[model samples]
Target: MSVENVRPVQSNCLLEVCVDSVAGLECAIEGGADRIELCSSLELGGLTPSAGFMQTAAHISPVPVYALNRPRSGDFVYSVLELDLIERDIEQARAAGLDGVVIGVSLPDLRLDIGALTRLKTAAKGLDCTLHRAFDLVPDFDVALEQAITLGFSRILSSGGALSAEQGLAMLRHLCKRSSGRISIMPGGGVGALNVPQFMALDGIKEVHGSCSSPSEAVHAKVTALGFASESSKHTDASKVRALKAALLVPSSD
Candidate 1:
């Protein structure tokens, strides 16, 4: 870790909760999340939230809310049309009074697409930016970390190039050290209250992210059979958020 950009140690770890609906947003806030990552289609790994969702989240969430700017599912590699869509989505986030935006662009080879990221960063000026988990797909983490820093992203939301933060503890620690104070490394993916202690144990990991969603409830059999919704869909639980915040010593609206 460079001494010059030494990351400051936090007195308490912050909890960033991901929410895909107004109900989830309310739950996260009621549960005491310090930050919110507002999005849609979380099962699709989170897509850019609708303008209405962004606006509503800004109005209701007392905590800083960062809107996911991803335009689609599949890979982060984007076409000109998709890039244009992403640019406008970012503008919408800012116009909706969001606190920040989460974004990433990748090459077909699984490396960060510097040109595309640069363009998106310019559009997101005046709002904080987070390099979202498209980072997990990077072929090289060290090179990608430097790219994120050079891009002026406030932080990188990653799982240490792994599927979950717990499984990637080693690499996550290294990233914490590598980032020093130049930027923050926020671990997400399968992180939650019960096992959050494992992640907060890392030195530079001052913040963590997760869905805090409860298991999907059984819906009417016909609902799934008719394709109204997936039987496996999960919903955010206020109790789970409160539990996590309690574990982290964060205050809640309750």
Candidate 2:
């Protein structure tokens, strides 16, 4: 790592892919992702995965597995019960020997709930805590950034409140410069190999997150003991993972 690249924590210009399935987890590892954010129900933003799944991923993943501690998909505002679930998920991830947990909470008015955030951070204790995309919903991005730093969040994944990281690149750059090494600004939501370098070249970004997905049409077969095999499979994009990794390897002039 270069001196300028020395973020508050160790920084790597690599892919942090979200895996909703065991096969996806393995694919992420095979493609050389720097880290994996394990979650379920990618269709609904993403919720906490089963403890068994968390354990299995941790046991076999070659890279760090950061379990998603979210309880639902709608808004980031959480009830007391939801908060409890988040804490429990964090504990389960720690017990499972995982790397970290990604979580977030904001006021109903779309502002940082410092108290609730502090509670979550405290619960995270020995594990790394990443403030999720909720940061992008904050009423004031700068204040939210400071609050995250004060609350001890190591990093954040955001899209500059825009629909995608590309649209939010300017704000992402501003946030990184304003961060002053206090926190890592990770860009996610619609990131890809083609744009990974753009995000990395922005001031203060050390990591980029996205799912590089492509179409695939491989048939999976099930074999029976009666010397008969049933062929059944759905199209799955198996190339995006590797392609994304390759995109990150393109060295930046900066």
Candidate 3:
């Protein structure tokens, strides 16, 4: 569906939960997520999920599912072949019936890759597109914000160049004000029940993105059985998602 045609979320302040597995998807949905960002290997900083996974999540999720289209873990600057791969991923997401795709591209100078993004946007066609956290790596936030708006991204997911949304509150507010409804500035990274109230106070934050993740003992055991030194397996926690949603509804102290 076109970005404009996407259904309004159930709550005024939408909660977007990022999940890597079917189990995580189930948890996010039960936890009252308004939307889901389907991906794989969150430890690698999120890679494009398999088509089967995307189809399964889209089929099972009640809310809109937006697939992450990153080809690799390292950086936002991609080679031509890598861009082609991303284009194919976007096509796969569309064919899988996902509501949107999250993506971003950058130049060596840390500027937005307008040409590459334009082609990716074309490949996305009718689906809603979000410029992902790659926005944080850009050298100039103001310039990048205008480029994202001109490129027609439905929203930009960022932590305002800080390590976490709470740490970047000031820049988040600045970007939100500068956006002026032309595009959405979604505060993500380290957002959870405890700090969501701070974001709610920001005037133009219509949506928030987070993993709301916690360590999973089951998965950790499996990894250990395979002889890998598993630090800990993380998955979206249903209770955390519910808590965040509840916190978003409470009036901010502002």
Candidate 4:
């Protein structure tokens, strides 16, 4: 394949898998995920993982792992102390050899908090930075896109303010086009193997994010004996990952 063709084929659909626990991390890596976003308390919409968890995830994950640095989950609005905690987490993640940091901050009015973001970026000096799905909550997607680039974010995880990626594909494509290579517009939320082909069919999308989940039937087991395995753990399945990858190849065939 020509380099340009191969380049897009290889990276046109980056799979970002979110892992709630160590088992989820292993599943994402085994499932052919290109990268991972590690966090705890998905029930609270994902808070920063503990130091021990961060260390273990970085060591075990085969693909690059990015730590979610949110101190709490209620909203993207953050306190100064929470920002400080996030900065410290970023430092720890980098030292632990994690690849990046996933963070978000916004004004009470739901606009990107430019000043807070600038500080967070500065703290993550040596690591890649991704503005998390909180981007979708910003009042103005267009304005947020511009600020993300200007603030030097490497990528953004969003769902176009919708509940799922499919619903947001139109806006996702628009953001990707407007980004103009200045930043990467990554469509996340409610992504799965079933929609990979549809997402690939849309123009300008280069990456996708999701937590492909199946119920953990073995939920009655305790972690002490099973060693961190949850009775209801959600992990990326390798078959699903391969299916999604294959689906992305269809456009090139056409």
lDDT for 214 in candidate 3 is 91
Q: Poorest 10 consecutive residues of model 3 by lDDT?
A: 1-10
Error of 4 at 111 (Å): 0.4
Residue pairs whose backbone atoms clash in candidate 4: 219-231
Q: Which stretches of candidate 1 lie over 4 Å from their true place?
A: 1-11, 250-254
Residue-level lDDT tens digits of model 2 in 97-189:
998999899899999888888898888898988999889998899889988898888998999999998999899999999999899999998
Off by over 4 Å in 4: 1-12, 221-236, 250-254
Model 3 C-alpha lDDT per residue in residues 1-254, reported as the tens digit of each score: 22233333366699999999988888788888899999998978799999999999877777899999998889899999999999999999999999999999989987999999999999999999999998999989999999999999999999999999899999999999999999988999999989888898898889999898998665566668886635666878989988888777755467
Judging by lDDT against the true structure, name the best candidate.
Answer: 3
lDDT tens digits by residue: candidate 4, 143-174:
99999999999998888788887898888888
- What is the lDDT of every predicted structure here? 0.88, 0.80, 0.89, 0.79
lDDT of 1 by residue, 133-224 (tens): 88999888999999999999999998887888889889999999999979999989888878888888888778889899997788999999
Q: Where does candidate 2 stray beyond 4 Å?
A: 1-12, 215-237, 251-254
Residue-level error in angstroms, candidate 4, position 241 = 3.2
TM-scores of all candidate predictions against the true structure: 0.92, 0.85, 0.92, 0.86
Model 1 lDDT, residue 14, Cα: 85
By TM-score: ranked, best first: 1, 3, 4, 2
Deviation in angstroms for 151 in model 1?
Answer: 0.6
RMSD, every candidate, angstroms? 7.3, 7.0, 4.5, 5.4
Preferred candidate (lDDT higher): 3 or 4: 3
Clashing pairs in 1: 5-181, 7-180, 7-181
